[model samples]
Target: MASSDDAPRVFQPLPGRTVDRSAAYHALLRELLSLVGAEAPADDEPRWQDRARLAVRKAVKARTVQGPVPEEWFEPMMRATVHEPDPSFVGHLVVPAVAAWGLRPVLLALLDHLDNGTPADVAGVARAWYHTGGAPEAEHEASRDLYRRYQHTALRRFVTLDDLDARRCLLPGLRLQHRSFPPDMHELVDQAVHLARTSDDDYLRHRVEIQTRLT
Candidate 1:
């Protein structure tokens, strides 16, 4: 989400990019495998997280000591077929990208992250949303069709319902003009503008109106 006068709209098709497991993923798996008496962590201290994973280790360790499930249960639970058999997904979510996305709490998280994120990182957050929304390339210069695609409905709801400052600061900011969408597509925008005008988390009456009016 570069703030260039012209933001590049690079949409990846199915099998877009290979997933890279971050340190965070490793930390969680290490903790889980240790809890099941499967794989002891190679290090005494956590290789990644300090407080959060340590807390989880303590809790799960406490539960395991209580023996809620028998050791016999661990073998079959490890073989659960409900899970995907993809080699890429064997231990963690290492799937390649696709145009489609599930409406997950992560979407809400991106909106929440925009306000507090550093100036350097703000565009990254916005880019994540734009890509996750599957927003296609600009259809109209005057009105960037951010919400025209059916795939973008979840994104539309998120951007519209998000706080004015975040909407103004992050994705689809003042630089971009919002298209007037169909009632079905635009319903959330109306609600958000109404909420904004009514002083709900909107300090300026025209916080949202001003953006929509952009040429």
Candidate 2:
């Protein structure tokens, strides 16, 4: 990855080529992670770290993945840095204007699917695309609303954080906020704690514990 000073130049917008789209995605992922100095596991035992690294790379460049940013908003997004409420793990999840413009189509696709189908069908499709484990229609709709309301922050996490875990965090927050499910933040924290223990990431575990205590 290049230095921060080179960010503006290294990430200048260009017309995306069909051939290099994947490469560009990898480049974007590497550049994004470089901002946080995230490291992969040692060459010998590389596993989660390596997968996480690759996932980040794949996500940004993923032609299949899409978002709701506007076409005309490209210039603004290029100038935009990942702001607060974005996950602290990956600081400033910035993207070029072209990428932002490209995202509108993707988001439109999702919305189209939602509006075109029944709520149940929308949930099924969103679950498959987002890899959520087939949540109920109401549950998924609540998440969709949360994703809509806090898109930028959610995108930062969605783009970089391991998809499963990020979704785990999001599910509870969304459920609590909209569906009134889980009763309150305490239930959300409890659920998060269980998920943290499901992983080996001490940092996430600590965060869950702290959230548990606070809630």
TM-score on alpha carbons, each prediction:
0.29, 0.27
Q: Which stretches of candidate 1 lie over 4 Å from their true place?
A: 1-127, 130-147, 150-156, 159-179, 203-206
Off by over 4 Å in 2: 1-71, 74-189
Q: What does candidate 2's lDDT look like per residue over 98-191, in tens digits?
A: 2433333333443444345333323222322232212234443434543353323332333234444334333322222222232333444344
Specify the poorest-scoring 10-residue window by lDDT in model 2: 5-14
TM-score for predicted model 1 compared with the true structure: 0.29
- Tens digit per residue, CA lDDT, model 1, 1-215: 33323332332111211233344345544545455455353455554333333433344445555645344433222222011122223212110111112223233344344444433223334444444332233322222332233224433533444443333323233222336444464556555555546664433354456545765
Which one wins on TM-score? 1
Candidate 1 contains a number of clashing pairs equal to 0
Which candidate number has the best lDDT?
1
Residue pair clashes in candidate 1: none
lDDT of each: 0.36, 0.33
Report, for all candidates in order, the number of backbone clashes: 0, 1
